[model samples]
Target chain A: MKGMTVIVKTITSWVKILIFLFGIYIILFGHLTPGGGFAGGVILASSYILIMLAYGRDFVEENLSLPAASRIDCLGAFSFAMIAILGLVFGGSFFVNFLFQKYLPGQPLNLVSAGTIPLSNIAIGLKVGASLFLVIVSLSICCKDFRPGTSVNKKKE
Target chain B: MIIFYCLLIFMLIAAIVAVETEKLLSSVICIGAIGFGASLMFLFLRAPDIAITQIVVEVLGLIILIRATISRDLTFITGDREFFEVVVSVVIVFVIFLAGIQVLQTLPDFGSPIFAQVADAPSNTYVSRGLGKTGAANLVTSVILDFRAYDTLGEATVLFTSIIGATVILRKKCRKKMEETTG
Candidate 1:
């Protein structure tokens, strides 16, 4: 898509960074706040959506390609499963808090205190944000009417 | 107390309007509004974490709904079968409402401490032992990621399945369009 008016593009360019940063903050500080992986992931996806709306598909593709997003999605899921398996290997349970118990220092409310929780949050945030962005991108690309000024058709030819 | 009931009434009205609306976009927006209202109700019920989750889910849901609706021509037809289906749905909804009232009457009042002493009451344990067990200040996060990791895994799996299904369903059509354009 060619995207919207210049005003929207300009404003989004400035605002999207803040939104993305806020999403990371939420994911990292999930153990201390109301927002966790899922909510932070949605926020991250929304930031990307804002960019797509303002800068169009080509811009998003250049910055974060579809294949890269898919890779990130898989990487996130793999990391989460690895964490669970680590729990089973060390603690004799599928999802036990082995790191918190055996290795990591436990301090309440600290960012580094939660052993597997924060790791899980990051993994989940990556998986959810990438997947949702992929969903929206795929759906919009499939739209029969809203092709971007014959560029895509020309490329196909 | 009165405000909570008022919110509930608003939620009911929103639901009815969402079901009755002719325009699919409008209906989806109304459902998003219902989610917003329900999040407010969750906050009033002293569950900020749930409220946040509800609002974020509402946003993603609205995005999906709008995208899905954009490509389709949505027109409503009220025929005999449609009317019959509507009546059946309404009856089922009313029956469920009555049953919910009956169940609510049998339960303890809101904020009753007796709930903490049940045999498998995780709420009390989470509140009492959660911070020490997980080194997380938020009890809900600890419960979800530490005490109940399997459920979170399942939820993640469901999300993965949905995205995969959406991709598969649309990938072929998109590829076909590209091929046709190329040829």
Candidate 2:
């Protein structure tokens, strides 16, 4: 849980919020941009990772928590499945695009016209972001002694 | 084309340097550079979607790989049999390269359409029909999420399963330790 010096913490505190916001923007605007669910998810996870590195694992766990991350991951996957199943029920095929109900040529360029693409993107973004954060958190837990400034005397106290 | 070849050669050099580096950290850095170069190459290939994906995936992979190496000893002794393994690997690579060249020769001209003259060429179909069919401006998104949704579903399942595996593998020992302490 012990973190780095004041410089890293200070910089990270300011920058992490921007990274998180950027990630959300990417996820939300995925249908219109180069970055989509996976890329945005990774960026989101990186923001968390930045927080973890600058503040400490204890700080991240206290705020986000490992269990919460796992739950979010499961929820993301479930939502994606639910969306797909809904498609099957309404559109007669698995993972069909049925939400927006319009597939006109010029309609595609608009933000809200892509039936299930944006929704699916959101689902994937959530899943990827949460899972990646969990993976990093779990891996960090495996190497407790590897972190810098793990004072042996502090452990005794 | 010249730029592409230049980037490719640089990538090749980076790969070789990554392999030959004695320090694991340096090797990791070299590999990351290779990945970055590759993403740039992907961009030059006119596939912005793939380039973005490549960059993000490369960074994620680099983070994980670096974390794995962080606690491990950086230096490893080169064994006597390494030479033989290298030779065998080189031979295999050469054979693959030759086979790839042969395949390329059999195919149509480079940079030309694979299905040039066909009425139902896949590229043509996707380009012409993607937006109308899926109502997504991004043709790649439409192709992935609507046209080939099943493949995407399978990919999602794979990712979910892998994460499950990671969590289970890492959680087991901690859970057992906690149980023992409580008991």
Candidate 3:
């Protein structure tokens, strides 16, 4: 499909950054706020999806590129498991609160509190955001059979 | 109370419209309306975490559905509607709804969990000591990440698998130009 109108692209350029920042806020403040890793991650992906909608497949692929997203997804999975396994090694139990228990008994409601929760949140957030972006990219790419500079042959609804 | 019921009714009407709409895009929008309605319900119920998740998921779902519908034609005409199948499905849905209502009636209460009565339950400890143990103000986050990290790990793994499968199958370049070999 062709990139949307100039209005959409212009607005997307400005708003996408804000949305991306908000998603990061949600992810980092998961322990203190109502949003968490999953929700924040989905929000992040939607920010990219908005760009994909405003721009076209080529732009997104050029920037976010399939391979980069795949690597991030793998890194997220690896880091999350490592966090869990590290808990077992340190706290003598799987998924234990090793940081809060031993290293730092953080004060509640503080941004830097919540031992490993924030780390896990970041890991999950990266994994989800990248995967959702990957899914959308793949789906859109599969339908990009049309030639450039032409509108998709969409049937009248 | 009245607003909750209103939202529920709105969602029901939107759901019906989604099922009845002729245009796939319109149907997707109507389904999105239903999701937003539920998200509003969650907000009214004071679960901002769930409301945020629901709204984002709904947006993504709407986007994906609209993208798929615009790209491909999914209308199928199997001519001669299967009345028997429809009837059976509707009957089953109604029975399930009735059974659910009965189960809900037997439940302790809405909004408040039965942690007090069940002293040995994990929820009791979570409600009482979640902040102290996890050092997170949000008990929901503490429970999900600290107490139940295993489930979250499994969920992330599932998403990873699905996304990997999608990408592997839908490579941008296909080997269509490969020379045909007769075995």
| Best prediction by DockQ | 3
Docking category of candidate 1: medium
Give stretches of model 2 more than 4 Å off: A102-106, A145-157, B106-108, B175-183
lDDT of 3 by residue, A42-157 (tens): 99999999999999878888888889999999998899999999999999999998999999877888888989999999999999999999998887766665322233223211
Interface RMSD (Å) of candidate 3: 4.3
TM-score for chain A as predicted in candidate 3: 0.90
Q: What would the TM-scores of all predictions be?
A: 0.88, 0.88, 0.91
* Candidate 2 lDDT tens digits, A37-130: 8788888998998888888888998889888998989988898899899988988878878776534223656777788888888998999999
Please give, for every candidate in the order listed, the TM-score of chain B alone compared with the true chain B: 0.81, 0.85, 0.87
Q: Name the runs in model 3 displaced over 4 angstroms.
A: A146-157, B74-80, B116-119, B174-183
Tens-digit lDDT track of model 1 for A10-85: 9998999998999999899999988899889989998998888788877997888888998988898888889999
Assess the local accuracy of residue A153 in candidate 1 as a C-alpha lDDT between 0 and 100: 58
**What is the DockQ (computed on Cα atoms) for candidate 2?**
0.48
Candidate 1 residue-wise lDDT, B119-175, digit = tens: 466777788888888888988889999999999999888888898887876664666
Q: What are the lDDT scores of the predictions, listed in order?
A: 0.85, 0.82, 0.87
Q: Is candidate 2 or candidate 3 better by lDDT?
A: 3
All DockQ scores: 0.50, 0.48, 0.56
CAPRI classification of candidate 2:
acceptable
Query: Better model by TM-score, 2 or 3?
Result: 3
Query: Considering every candidate listed, which one attains the maximal TM-score?
Result: 3
